[model samples]
Target: MQTEHDSTYISFSREEWASLHPSSQINLTQSEINHIQGLIGNLTNEEISKIYLPLIEYLSINMEAAKFSHHVKNQFLKKATKNPPFIIGIAGSVAVGKSTTSRILQSLLLDLPARPKVDLITTDGFLFSNNVLKAKGLSERKGFPESYNIRALIDFLSAVKSGEPCVQAPVYSHLYYDIVPGQYHQVCQPDIVIIEGINVLQTPKQVGSSIPSRVVSDFFDISIYVDADESHILKWYVERFKLLKKTAFTKPESYFKRFAELSDVEAEGVATDIWNRINKVNLEENILPTKYRADLIIEKSSNHQVDNIRVRKN
Candidate 1:
């Protein structure tokens, strides 16, 4: 890793980063890899070895340090060392592949020597339901920070960090395009939790000094931001929309069923417009501003391959 421009980050090229992988061989089976790879994501064994192995090595080291600190703290207080999850927050723009990255991390992290339990959750579930958004007139800004139930998200994180058992997180469905009422994913106190969302890195503003609450990112031991050129992200988003139009949107129960009737040309036009009006604005106004706050930044090429990595200097 090399420092440039007196920046807060130490940047590493793909090959340079790969050379730092842990000594022990770590193999991910083809089926496991296939399961982590998403429809819009590209990951091969080579990329894992090159881009992710070194990362896994780094995270393992940090996990060990966290355990040591916990042991030390508990010992000082004459208490047993209880498991406190090492929370990881992953932030990125829509279609920037954050979900795929989080899934890969969760899968690999679980296989470490301890065979720890790992849980993955997305901030999408924290988003307000369509009914709520429409009621608040934030329907056009669905992904914007204002559209989310920030208090609930932070409360859930607080519970997890405090080692609360069977903590439930709201469930969201892309088919319904909203949070499913009364459905939740129970998070049993795991060794690690990976929370992925565009809002993860954002530091919520404390308006008017109401009893200061712990921000969501504060609960994270490590934070990552997936980044790609806006043009590339725009293209990927449109392509994903087109694919969804043919598949998901065709389902009778889908909230976007109307989109299934559109011609290819019309679908692309609508997708591009949505990208410009909603996603582009959100990326520029909120998401991009928080990139520097992440502990690590994963830079992707136009082809969606991780090309460079930036780790914030200690």
Candidate 2:
């Protein structure tokens, strides 16, 4: 039986979901188990189980629906036909846990009974290099839509949808805070492609218009936006910054190595300042505006649990 999370939609909670399939268990690989254990400090196993299991189930169902839809569309074209890959776009604000969500979904979706080959591609790879952004005088607008190679991203997606044998996408290195030249991820024909980013659903800027036009979302078969209050997201960002400073920033090659020596107070202040100056402004001016366009919205509370979900009606 389906349970309504709200008046308009029906979905199961983690506990309820667990009860439904007594014989089935979520089998995690050793590395995946370790990853979940690490997150145990901030999230409970039950929470992860409940939030993600259902999400994976939903994605599997949707992926099949997408495949069927593609097949039906192709039936009309006869022998000249090829179905495009189903593209799922995920968007959210910084520190809203969208990255974790994307990764989890990618793993879970691959484990489905359909056993569809899945590929995870992040839009971060499409971001212009620091030098390019600096030359264009847009370095400070790092996560802004204009900071990416929109056409290149679109071309990559188009190739993937067309079932190209091999497609290469540039890689972005968070440690170095730059695009690593000559390093790319090759994606073969995948049943589904998950594209995650800060502004995946945004409309591209028109060629000559003052505002940016939309590029990628136009190709998505389904889209999700991770949502939370601005204040809550800000706090999460600050906490994550502190955590990363204590860990990743200590690496000599890290772009934020200088942050490792900061006092807690100084680090908090710096994180707050960056949030205010860059992330917050970009969320307001670009990201949030596209929320309504999402097929589904996952709303999280300050504690990072998804308390509610909004699914658009057919």
Best by TM-score: 1
Alpha-carbon RMSD to native, per candidate: 2.3, 3.9
- The residue-by-residue lDDT of candidate 1 on 124-208, one tens digit each, is 9999999999999999999998898988999999999889977999999999999999999999999899999998887767656
TM-score of predicted structure 1: 0.94
Clashes of each: 0, 8
Best by lDDT: 1
Q: Which stretches of candidate 1 lie over 4 Å from their true place?
A: 1-6, 22-32, 206-212
Off by over 4 Å in 2: 1-41, 209-214
Candidate 1 scores a C-alpha RMSD against the true structure in Å of 2.3
